[model samples]
Target: MLPPRTYVFFGLNAVRILGIISMLLVFASSIFVLVHDVQAVNRFMAEASESDMQDCDYIPGSTVPNQPAGVFWAVVNRLLIIFQVIILILSEVGWPLAFFDRFFPVLGSAFGLGALGIFQALIGAAILSHHVDDFTLVTAFFLFAIGCLNMLLGLIFREGAKARRSITNWRAQAKSVLPSAEDFRPAFVRPNSSFVPSMFKSGAGEERAEKSGFGFGRQGEKAAGLKGFLISKPLESLPRYAPPPRSEGSRSNSPEPQFKSSKYAI
Candidate 1:
């Protein structure tokens, strides 16, 4: 049943470490991939494909149409998008709680939905027929990566749900093992209040020698005292089913372990 809450704690830690390692790698990879090739970094930055170059065209005297830079921009945007998604998901789900519980999984699901939207668009569009291999590979990688992350989030939520079910079952069993509220409740006191000595004062106030009915506290005290304070009654004097007293002397002389107790009245 999800191996208890302790296992969940371990799962959380593992998820955090995994996220940290992944985030650093993804961030570095995103930045490193920003350049098209070795030449782009070494030479292109100095030239003016930089967009800082004024647009110009020689259609006689027409304004220059902006030239599409290269697939490098596409790759850069995709990388940035992926890195952003990773950072967001890890921050929302993979932090303090791993095996992310309810909230993060929901957020991850929303991200998955967004990814699905892109997947749909990629599947429908055909702008890169000449570079079919390139477009297909990039699209497939994005979909696969997003799907895997979404699936991991689902697993975390599934485990949390399992843990919840087990707790419910434990509560059901524990209710049966536990003593009921009524069992520990003393009849001499208020329904939930502490034992009050005044409950025992009634028997002592009878006008006649002993005509009044026995008070609840007197009966309880006498019964408890027989076990704890007067366990030395002779066999003939004991109740029919009474077992032999474990102690035969006053409590002060008893060899049995005694709990030292002090009472406070409020």
Candidate 2:
């Protein structure tokens, strides 16, 4: 069976999803209302009689009335435009803020939604009073739906803190059971040490090189050659290659002495 925390997490997610869906529907419906309003206004202007046109307030290049009722529809259009802008800003800003501070976004969205509900209620009342048309009544209904969904989502966000905490604890426990990076290393293998070349000399040879001022035979020769090349000097100008000087007691001309064991002499 799934854990309680898992259920809670999913429930919260579902609420948030519903909230998003409702808001999107509201946005689409509002756009439809705006378009319908524009078409209605144009139709009214086209069908208006010559006497009615004179009674209507004149807008440049159009005979649409601007005085009493025209101004009201114009105001509604502006309000819908502002509402769209607010919805866009809230969605863009509030969602990311929710990731950091959950409570604030929840409260803010709730407040905004409540305000939308009130606005829609007023529009619905206007429609009932014959101040606005049936299209606005439909828009009002969409706004009310969006407002309810947003409020429900806000309530879920506010109450889901305990669920969030449980989920976080579950994650930490899961992490504890997993292997760490260090555990991935091979247990039987040792780390490699810095490399020492096979040609490296020790003891007497090392001391001899140190005493001669050159670090090593091959390295000194190579360094000198490279230095000559870098300085633009000809190969002939380089020092003549000479054998390393031998100690007086250990001359190369002396043959190594051989020892004879008496028991093996036969």
Candidate 3:
């Protein structure tokens, strides 16, 4: 699997960089509006030859007359005031989001983007509608939001690519570890006892006498004392190399000695 630490650190840094950029844009745009507001007031005060009424704070003080903007400059000045407030709000959010983003960087980035995109796009659309030709300084905010969105997408794709490679490598390793089918074979588990004389009896009690040392019957005489398959010549008996196998009914005791009788009529 992909290393978790590398993936998370890289993804987090991407979000942090985006946040810093957002904050920078906020500061830059705010300063531009503040300077523009001062310049407009100075030009008006210089032409009218009156005392200064505007404050040097973030936004220009609200109009004392409480009337709609009359001249083009008046409209431009009020728009600048709105832009200043937005910049302060954005800057407040950006740096704080960056700090909190380490735990859930992706989610934090999405949250930041949501706020940034809506406000910047709204302002951009408004500027375009007004045909304001000198909004270059404030345009940084729009670009920054768009840039953050791209960075977030890039991080997502990078993690996905790493994960896919890890899976492929795992499957390849498993294939190497598994045993092959060609090495398998079954076993033989039973004894070979097919050579008994009864097997050649042909479904009867009589067995065909043959010179192959297998016999079960003779003419009409029956050797009654102790009958067994006998050999005509000892050399034609069972092979000499084979071990003597005891018969099923035979015992280990010695056989009785044979008795001899004198030739006399009783």
Q: Which candidate is the best by TM-score?
A: 2
Encode model 3's per-residue lDDT on 149-238: one tens digit a residue.
644544455434222323344466457857544433322222433445444545323343432332345531244213563436345467
Best by lDDT: 2
Separately for all candidates shown, the number of backbone clashes (residues 3 or more apart, or on different chains) is 0, 0, 0
lDDT for model 2 comes to 0.50
Rate residue 60 of model 2 by lDDT.
27
Cα-based lDDT at residue 14, candidate 3: 55
Question: Candidate 2: misplaced stretches above 4 Å?
Answer: 50-143, 149-266
**lDDT of each residue in 191-264, candidate 2, tens digit only:** 54222332244458656554444454666667667668332435544356966667987776799898878876
Clashes of 2: 0
Off by over 4 Å in 3: 1-12, 48-116, 123-135, 138-266
Task: Give the range of the ten consecutive residues with the poorest summed lDDT in model 3.
Answer: 57-66
